[model samples]
Target: MKKDKHIDPYKHVAFIYPDIMDFVDYKWWAKYIYSITVNHLKKSPSVLELGAGNCKMAAYLSEDYKDYIASDISLSMLSGSVCKINKVCCDMTALPFNKKFDLIFSAFDSINYLTSKAKLQTLFQQVYSNLTDEGIFAFDAALINNSYKLQKVAETSGNFNGIKYYRKSKFYPVSRIHKNIFRIYFSDKVITEIHTQKIFEFETYFEVAEKCNLYVADCLKAFTYRKAKATSDRVQFIMKRKT
Candidate 1:
């Protein structure tokens, strides 16, 4: 099958396998993201989440905020979510809103799918423009070692609600890209989805943030308070629009 480069990969999966979210273990991650976000902002601040997949994390963090908007490119993906909040189907690179927010964030390595540095900088600028003077834009990055320095094949196969799925992940060092292939065979239908994410260099992030006039306040190893290094598997970067 010819993959559509223009389409969001999750769109098809969401339509065909909406029940897949129930099988995944995403609670711990949602809690961790909330922990990092809560400490930086006050209670009941307007928030925007980019690449909010299935609204799992938003569901976890929404109770503490006054306003929350979750946006994803795929409408089907957003619909699969149980969250009953403000949801929008939109691209991450071009946020189509004038209302500013106190905190803007993205979770689950969604930014890595941005294949180039230019797109990343544009996203940073958009987030900066959409935030208040002292607002925060928090996101995480998968570092070089996360994709390039690993030689492993990790997979999870399971059945849920009569749907059987096999998800396989493999990293290609030459291109510094990781591919997640989800093959679902159920109800006499065979659907395969290929999702890809790139491992960006540490300095690339700082350079893009600098170009966008956004100052990074924290770059920590994910799920921990340790400083993020070039080799950190996953690094969370918290930034704000320059005052």
Candidate 2:
């Protein structure tokens, strides 16, 4: 038996991300995010998307603003953009931009990737530093409910462009961690990527945001304006930079 080669998250799997996430409605999601942006800013605003893997959402979301940049930690992932968009490869907690953005958002529950509260606070501080005076920082977080429900799916496998891939998902309730292990077979080697997400409590987000000098404008149920409860599967938070 051959040993599987370990790779960084999204390094090799970025190539088949679209195929794996085919169920996502990027267009509709872009529209939903756009509505939130307009509701807060009341106009098209300069935009920055953090953890914009593959930039699929950027393809449609970028259309709403004249100045838009898609950023992710993995260069391989940013290279998978569906169309031409200003792409920056950088860490969300340590952004490397001089200019501020009016609207900074991350979709697909990307904020859950921060494994610790300190990192989450750092990310919010970074957002506070990079946001315009009236800027909004919007992001969705996958809660415990999402992880519990997804754990039932357990395993899935498929092939994309002749490359075979398999995924197994697990949730650790005690640790509040949701982990996904992926095995992708290339012609020569099998690459393994382990993706982990923290399942933060519903109220912890507000505490972190407040500590980072960011004001929580709203915390809504995912895809809607309804208030989110502790049992919500996912929630979207709208934060504003402290003036």
The candidate maximizing lDDT is 2
> Where in model 1 is the C-alpha error above 4 Å?
1-6, 15-28, 148-151
Assess every candidate by TM-score: 0.88, 0.95
The reply for model 2, stretches above 4 Å from the true place, is 1-8
- RMSD of candidate 2 to true structure, Å: 4.4
* lDDT for predicted candidate 2 compared with the true structure: 0.89
Among residues 3 or more apart in sequence or in different chains, the pairs in candidate 2 whose N, CA or C atoms overlap within 3 Å are none
Worst 10 residues of 1 by lDDT: 15-24
Candidate 1 lDDT score at position 76: 77
lDDT digits (tens) for residues 1-243 of candidate 1? 986565666855675454645655566776776777777776678999999878877886787674999999877788888889999988899899989999999976889988788888889889988988877888888877666444454777777667788888888777777888899876878888898887777888999999999988988998788998887988998987787
lDDT per model vs. reference: 0.82, 0.89
Q: For model 2, what is the error of residue 223's alpha carbon versus the real structure, in angstroms, after optimal superposition? A: 1.1
